[model samples]
Target: MTATHHTTVELAKLARVLDRDPGDLAFLATLPPEALREFRDQITDLTARREARRMQRVGAAAKIVPAPIAAKIAEAAFGPVLAAAIAGSVDPARAVAIASALSPVFLADATLTLDPRRAVELIAQVPAPMAAAVARELISRGDYLTMGNLAGSVPDSVLRAALPHASDLDILQVGYYLEETSAADRLLTVVTDRVPGVIRATHNAGEWPKAITLLGLLGPTERSKLANVVAAQDDEVIDGLLTAVEEADAWDTLLPVAAGMNPQSLQRLAQRPAMQNPTLLTKVADLALTQNLWLSLLPLATHLSPTQLHTVAARVATEPDASLTTLIEQAHTENHWPTLLPVALALSTPDRKRLASLPVMHRPEFLTAAIKATATHNLWPAALPLLNNLPTTTHDTLATTINTLTDTEFQAAVQAAVQAAVQAAPAADCTATLIQILLRQDFAPRSRSLTLINEAGNLETLVGTITTRDLALWEGLSDIRTEIPGHLRNLLAAQATRCGRPELADNLTAT
Candidate 1:
């Protein structure tokens, strides 16, 4: 569970003990959930002990009275609070008989004051029908805390009968007050088919926080089931879910469910119109960076439109370097390159360069994974620009991986770079980075690779890059001069001369 929702649940339980509104103790939200629970337990213990002797006296008297008469006197004279106080002390068989004879209304009244720990045996022995009756009374009165307490003690058979009487909203309200995840899971297990209706009702009632809190209490299979149901809802429901998270800043509560969703369901959620909202996208991005939710958010990000991807990328660009480093390491650790590469591609050039300069980017394993993912994802256009910005210290590491690519992978990179150059202005940095890697490889493969580049009509772009940046590229090319066709070599000489590199022109001509 998220800290925000956990703290809210603790506060609600504490508020019930004090008979105050949860909002009345809003200041308690500043305390950790453990402290809140400990304090509430201590107070409950004190309250239970305060009337111990008096309640024991009532119990002793009730043992002698017939069940029906005791039920009447307990309701009419003892009242609900006193009746509940003496319930735990009564003999289990007599207590069950007395409870069965009382009106559900009176029982419902007593239930609110009954501590489940003290009356567990009596609660378990109550007939299923009577328990359901009391549950219905609590539901009608909107006393979900009492209903939740009863739910914790009742048999699964009783809950199965009782829960259908409550509306979807009633279930969520009751779930919010449930002190045990096991109880909430048991309650939800009995009504698994109702989950869709419950989610729809949550949106209609604007109770997303409560719905999300209920989601946190479910076991994994049920949690994923609920998350998928939410993902499959119509646009309005999806919008409400986002609105609630944004309002409460509760992305932590929602993200784990999202991370667990199947790809199609995740894609459905990613395509929601509300997800494209820039402010919401930025908030989610910031939270993901700070909380290490990239494992969850990145897959969803891959399904976003290009415009939304850019919005998320811009937010990511503004985060601190340490956070950015963690993002890269997480992506590497999870093998989430297919998910993360597009967002990285969406960053502006300067931001992309900043990302490429992170120390993690220099690791051989990271660069190798990146190169492999770039080919697998057909992301050469984006990858080339970022690769151009990698620190020179890492170039040999990148080249080692580049040199080991299979014939198909190596040719794919060459063809992709050539295709990129043809479709846009000459990418000088891309050509130079490829040349630098080629220069590091053995002659036979480098010659074959250069032959493919020449056949792809990329000699002009290559020569242009060599002339403008490093005349030494001409010297590197001279070693494989025989691999260069006569016409392309003439083109290289003319460009080198045109760019005022007479010595490079001579070197190309000499070979």
Candidate 2:
């Protein structure tokens, strides 16, 4: 070949690397962005040409052609395009021989991009060194979508035999393959499953949510096994658990999480209970109320009922500081009415007479609790004096407590003007908290239950609670639609569909 032709080929290769249009100086300045990209994709692979050259030389050795004429093919890094094409032909023996001759070229052209399926097919026919080279290239840069399909395509025996000699000296071979397979759960198994490279890929892929879901093999047992991993890493695994929860909410996936004491850890996270809102602190109460120690409920026994009062009272009855009769006596006089009621309610009971006689400031709280527990006239009559004394804070508490009251009490309060009671709270001070609270459907926040988000909040700063509640109620109503009732189960379906969340949209519809 002429020196000019060799120079031109070198220039084309350079142009390909720089992603420029092959030299036509007259038009170079005019190339559009689209034209530049096209030029780059067009020249990215030199494998075909390299393979052809090798085959041509091999063919020459069998022919009368002079060796110098064939020697031209020996310079390229891979088999010439003609050789790969010939090897890729249906003749298996010829394919193997062609690959064996080209193995060295593959090792040299290590960065050559390969077709995933084609590499899987052609690698088997390749000589060992060449197959290793090709496998390394595919593992490093081939399309991830092809990993599982390709792994399963190969007979595991041949693949396993080839694995030890694979170019994957570290774990990324398996990493990239696992990534391609979308099976991250296999990471632990890959680590302990006696597959070195496989585990590395699995470990890396475990960090990504999509891959973990694909793996489908991780369960509660595996999570508990890995609990001793670093906290930061454990957090990452928790994130994976969170995604699994959002996707399936399965029991197996839920139970093993207690190992990590995370902030979001809510116990009994079986399928979201039949009720949308479950009392979270009730579990905390459970841990506290269990019967091992007698004084577990000592600090707050005055608020509990005859049955409940006695049960927890028995636990605290042994307190060295106070006699059981002293505890009962203090509860009788109601010096500690407020604290006692909350404790009583937590225990699912209220000292009925003491709760009824609580200060005007506290009457709404206990009455509201009693109302919710289906208590009757006595609870309502006890709450009446507090009607005018109720502050906006107390009103916020009563919003919830009122919901628990008997319909008769609810009617009396509504007649007493709940609309006005809501208005009395400073619009700014209560607006944000009330909005968030109502969003959660928690109606009561008595003087005792409220934290008073801002104490210095002025009258101007006080948000009228009614307006905020109305806005939240409307917003939720929009989401909790029932336009098509009966068999048409979901009203949110139409909205979800318009937003491209068909899965959520479908949940809004009936079968």
The most accurate candidate by TM-score is 1
Candidate 2 lDDT, tens digit per residue, 432-497? 333333334342332212222222123122222223223444354335433323322232344345
Error of 2 at 235 (Å): 8.0
Overall local distance difference test of candidate 2: 0.36
Model 2 quality (TM-score): 0.28
Candidate 1's C-alpha runs over 4 A off are 1-15, 19-34, 50-79, 86-102, 118-127, 152-157, 180-189, 212-224, 255-257, 290-296, 375-378, 403-412, 425-428, 442-468, 481-511
- Estimate the TM-score of every prediction: 0.79, 0.28
Lowest-scoring 10 consecutive residues by lDDT in candidate 2?
267-276
